[model samples]
Target: MDPHQANAMTTLSLFAHARALTAALACFGAAAIVTASGSTAHASPPASKKDSKAMTTSKPCPKGNLERSQCMIRLLLDDVAKTYDGSGGGGISAIRALNTTTFAVSLPQEGRIDVLTYEFELHPDGRVAIKSRTPSTQNVGPGTGK
Candidate 1:
């Protein structure tokens, strides 16, 4: 695929990952508050009263070998978690190679499972570019998602 198409696919993949992560973290946060309250049932805090705008942000994919690419992705995931007010569990669960130029990574933390699959290719300039991505919930099974 052309570089532009590859970048578009990569962006979609990242978006899926971030959306799942955000939802999972939000659920976890709500659960934590409830558990800490110790049976004193309380209503969830109100949603933001002000208008919320979507954010469009991008960062250059880290360069180098596959291992280094995996490391960089992991660190980026950790940073994203923190941005959503969530904590990381120190490391990811797995970064499995799907092929010589593709990988499937799993990040399990705080009872949630997130999986990101992507193909990477090295540009002529030596920068690693993600060719495509498909992110989903790892723990979700058939008969779920009602």
Candidate 2:
């Protein structure tokens, strides 16, 4: 990725994180909105209205890492919680295309499930349709269920 584009992505991601922080803080006025372990941090409000227009499901995604940026992932993960097991618990970290069409999404390390990666592909019709979700394993760790 170009340095400028990388910078822009960083800026955009920071802005989004800030926005999430603001919304989270403002929502409850307490630090409970964010968790240090990241095991249970609440998601911020949806991107602003203009973000919808900026992020279209069409080809030629905006500048930056189109395949990995939050914009693309957010748009694609509209109903991610519906199918991705254990997705409801932790946050998403990365989205990498294993091939031209297949993508490997990195999920947060839940208790006893470290380095879990899910490979999926979107429908050719330009929608968030998952063709399949086969996972590759790594290792596990102890986690507090409390």
Q: CA lDDT of each candidate?
A: 0.40, 0.37
Per-candidate clashes, comma-separated: 0, 0
Segments of candidate 1 deviating more than 4 angstroms: 1-91, 109-112, 140-146
78: Cα error in model 2, Å: 2.3
| Model 2 spans with C-alpha error above 4 angstroms | 1-76, 85-88, 111-129, 141-146
Say which candidate scores most in lDDT: 1
What's model 2's TM-score? Answer: 0.36
TM-score of each: 0.37, 0.36
Alpha-carbon shift of residue 82 in model 2 (angstroms):
1.9
